[model samples]
Target chain A: MQQENSVSKLKYFPVTAFSVVMGLSGLAILLYRAYHLGWLPLWAYLAAAFTALVVFAMFVFIYGLKAIWYFEEVKKEYNHKVKVNFFSAISISFLLVSVAFYGYLPFVSAGLWYAGVIAHLLLTFHTVVFWIRSEFEVHDINPAWFIPVVGNLIIPVVGVDLAPTWVNIYFFITGMFFWITLFAIVLYRLVFHKQLAEKFIPTMFIFIAPPAVIFISYFRMFLNVDVFSMSMLSLALFFLGLLVFLVKDFFRIRFYLSWWAYTFPVSALGIAMMIAYQATGFSVFKYIAVFVLVLTAAIVAAVMAFTVKNVVLGKICVMED
Target chain B: MKNVTVVVVYIFGLITGILATGFLINISAETVLLKEMASPYDFEKTVEVLAKRINSTKNWHVTAVIDQAAEVKGHGEGDIGKLKIVQYCSGKYAYEVLADDNRKKISVMMPKTFSVYEKNDGRVYIAVMNGSFVGKIFKGETYEILEKVSLEVEALLNFINFKFSLF
Candidate 1:
């Protein structure tokens, strides 16, 4: 049984520890120089850094709490090393920040939004090699575990906004696959390999956050690309849901009516598209047709699932126990 | 022993002790001087377009001033009249956000900044933010309209990169 205080206590570390540290470290150098030398508008840099740092600090505290909770869940003896990964991740950020602030402009800061690009490319390469030969074998990797860690790595990548496709695809595919595969693995493990089914909560952002971005990106809002890239994002999230529901190992309470949370944001977008297609007056029949289109799509997906072997199930079935 | 470890990992948590966010926001300034604006963004058009996109936002101002405008001393034609800084925020939302919690310093990044400028010999540069970054600060119960607002900002920035050749 899960303890109440324990579970409640273990929140926030992953979000805070690495993200804030690196983000500030990378960006703070600029603020520090501006203030000491009085080069750029000090107020804005200070404000962004201060705000980001405070938020980062709280998130770090929360991440630590979660680490403690994880220790509590594992029922393991612990100390500061509980957040060893987090510290290292933050350490890297510190290193990058220090390097960045010392006036090492690789190209251009582009915009702060692109800051993740640098970190993304670096981690993308690192993670790709790491994934191709991940030492963490024998057990299924946790999406929550990897997202923060890899994200910690890529978090710094945004230092500049753009990178060649080859750079990002490596990280993008690896990151997405890890989570996507994690979702698949969870399903089969729940069905047949029960022992491997640990407390699995797919990181909230793994699907909802990123793919929503994929859709937002579809407007060609930030990066201009073809429809297929955006469409794949929608497909990725859908598969994520398929993986979530297919798994018996999930935090069912969170799922109770959450398919709606998963569906509404995206589907309404489609409905809006339909409205645009019709233009002007409302048609009840059109609304019905739109409803049917969504329902049919969901059904098609479910049908496809039956034909596909569960990734975890396939793995377990082949394992020699 | 195993269960005990779980309890401990469950106890202290990973990021508990550090004050991860605000430290940097309030930090003393330094310049890495990394930003190389290939081309300056047309802030006037950007502000006009963006103001209409955001709901309840008021007194929006965007500028493309010399590096001296930011009060920064230039090194090699450093701020040589190349960069643009865009500052924007919503009026009522700012008030509502501040009133919510003292620690919601994330919200204080309101009237946020988006800088656009040109690198020497001209490469037009334009950029804004990712939704996830802003989503953290918005903190509404429902991501419904908030998600759209985030998307709109991204879209506006993308438009600059696309139609205006900012990117």
Candidate 2:
């Protein structure tokens, strides 16, 4: 009876839990890029990558159990207004893990890339259709909405090698179009509507991911630092700056699962800065890259600590109101 | 009013000085610390010739030939044309640099690199750190050794007829 009661808690496992994998995988990719820049040792990258893989496996196992035991709960989350957006985190996690491992295991990376691309595309289609069919208040809009769009942008990062150029371009264009459309809507909502609830505040960082990921994908495809790529990078930096300016608000918020939202976007920006430094050979970008990478590492460490604390306190994996 | 004018001028002058100094450092750092030259051979042949030359030299051995383009592609960063970094080291030079405990930090520059890459244009080029210039920065025994190393490395690339320029 005790074991069965404990196991029943699986029903409370939120789909947003997948964001933890996205955060860890993003940090893994950032560390990998830092290794190439000669700023960090190879072991650092390997450690982060290994940890991400382990965490990803754990999440998949637990979530799989949740899906099996509580299919109706999973369906409820799927139909949820904001929770539905995080399902794409599952796909983004796969793509990021594929990128994190691309340097060491090309074959395995290719398989993961294919799986990630296909799954993300299906999620994007589902999310978009659901958006069109459903009615949502302006207050329902949040930065999490960018999750599916950003996943599209990530396709070309690893997809540049796994798929044809046209296929990469297809995802890139779709991501870019939706990112802009959502940005306008999200911004309007933020300015005109009430502030986001404390639980969702950390997701303001997602504003940084789309442009940063777009910059990396664009640079990977063209291998040049032209106006368009620079613009994307600058926009990412601007969002990062805006978040830093609002650091007081972020500091006051209590820990929530959405805190994982702060991790990947910052890591994506760090990777983008490293790529900018590589493409342009500018020391300024190198300095910014180091700064952002250190910040990303710190953020991931803090979130992990908080997550562990919450799990031990029995605050996590509990039913939500 | 006169004091305020003076303060404004001082602030403006400081800003201008900082900007000018930054511009100068940026330009000088690139030119003073590196050398670039066009390679008569194609991209693959250029790396092959450079590796062979380094191997043939006395007391020098090619440590590694890193296919940077392949590495970048595998990392999925993007294609950077055909770029190869030919890393070579000399046991004698390594000993000389490391002989002094104080100068051990210079080992970071060891296993010296020669980057041979194809640009957007249909030409192959070789770029390496200007050892002579770097040696001059740490004048004395280190200078003499690095200057010799620089000359010897330049001699290894004699097959390339083009004049080396700090681009």
Candidate 3:
């Protein structure tokens, strides 16, 4: 009976936690830079904290590697169209590390960039191949698909100066086109197909990522202000405004690794705001940057704390529906 | 046959005109923004030379040297050639700038960063951000300090380039 009860209590950790670990770690590194720039003196501690989370993320990645026995469930989740896109969050985390450390620790950042670039490309290419080779119901389409696509947009962030201009342009164009294609499909699904599953609802915030990420990418790659960059910023702000009302339901959901779905998009928005401030020298953008930095930092920290608590209480890393 | 020959000449002329225009625009833009140096030394040697100069200077120290190529390899992949960022800061200048409440915000742009990279053609280049142009964004003492720092930083890079060029 004791052994049976132990087995019963074991909850299977979802692969989605890969994203949570990455998202929070990425956010922490962003905050460290923000604090450093703002002269807040919290940069050092945050850097240490981020490193710790990176170590933990490595372990989680290993666990995911061994979870191949769960292939049946993985395939089911993968074919679901929306759910599989969350896998891209793991890619985002590595890319985030690359950007954060690009200045302070070049070698580490470069390594992470290479890792992020290869992983994101494979993930994205395979996803596209899947889309071409398989058929999915129209209703299954949602914003989560944007996750895999955003990886391309993210390359230009650090890769702008590091990679050749042509390579960066390739990623920028790929990301831009796919973002448009998915935006149309996702909008149609929202209006006509069906409401998204409750667990996947928070991913609505993902719509905010492409514009924000692309804006940052364009500015970094070209190192100049242009019409396209301005448009990206404008669209990003508009979508972010729309998400304000949409995310009301997100806060009501219970804590799950899916909560990490909210982290990177917000962090990207914050980074975009900073880039805008850098370009325009506007005080308003500066204030907005600080606001986003604090808000995402709080969200990531709270989620991380809760995650640890759940793990200790045997709520994570076991089997559950 | 006569008409086809004329059309081909016109097409070639149009392409030549476009290329000439592009070349002129690139030259003008280069003059307007950025003070760059071409290094005969490889990317790593170029960074090492500059880092040594900064270290030897008074009131300035090399805080960090970021080897971007090594970083990519650390992630279980091959290196990305030679891209690096060398960060340096003057303690005296930083203290002077941050001592005031008004100028504290510019601290975010601190540590005076410059990038060294080898492009696809295998030519090495060092690019420095114009601190003075950035300083123009601010007003008062902070702006003055940024302007001063910008010139000093520019001079440092040029000095490094000159010193390396000699060797």
Taking chain A by itself, what TM-score does each prediction score? Answer: 0.37, 0.98, 0.87
Instruction: TM-score each candidate.
Output: 0.34, 0.69, 0.64
User: lDDT value for candidate 3?
Assistant: 0.70
- Write model 2 residue lDDT over A1-321, tens digit each, in one string: 867656756888888988998999899899977866557866788899889888888887788667656779888998888988999998888898889886545445556666688789999999999999899899989999999999999998866654567988999999999999999999999999999999999999999999999989986665545677788999999999999899999999898989999999999999999887765567999999999999999999999999999988878877775
Interface RMSD for candidate 3 relative to the native interface: 19.6
C-alpha lDDT (0 to 100) for residue A239 of candidate 3? 80
Model 3 agreement with the true structure over A75-134: per-residue lDDT tens digits = 665565555676676676678766765534444555667668878988888889888877
Ranking by TM-score: 2, 3, 1
Query: Which of the numbered candidates is closest to the native, going by highest lDDT?
Result: 2
Give the alpha carbon lDDT tens digit for every residue of B22-114 in model 2: 554454455436667778779998999999999999999999999988999999798888999999999998998899998899999988999
DockQ of each: 0.06, 0.02, 0.03
Interface RMSD, per-candidate values to 1 decimal: 15.0, 22.5, 19.6
Taking the tens digit of each residue's C-alpha lDDT, what string does model 3 give over B53-162? Answer: 78887888999999878898999998678889999999989998999887788788778887899989989888876454345456556654664575456446543323
> By the lDDT metric, which is better: model 1 or model 3?
3
lDDT against true structure, model 1: 0.38
For TM-score, the strongest prediction is 2
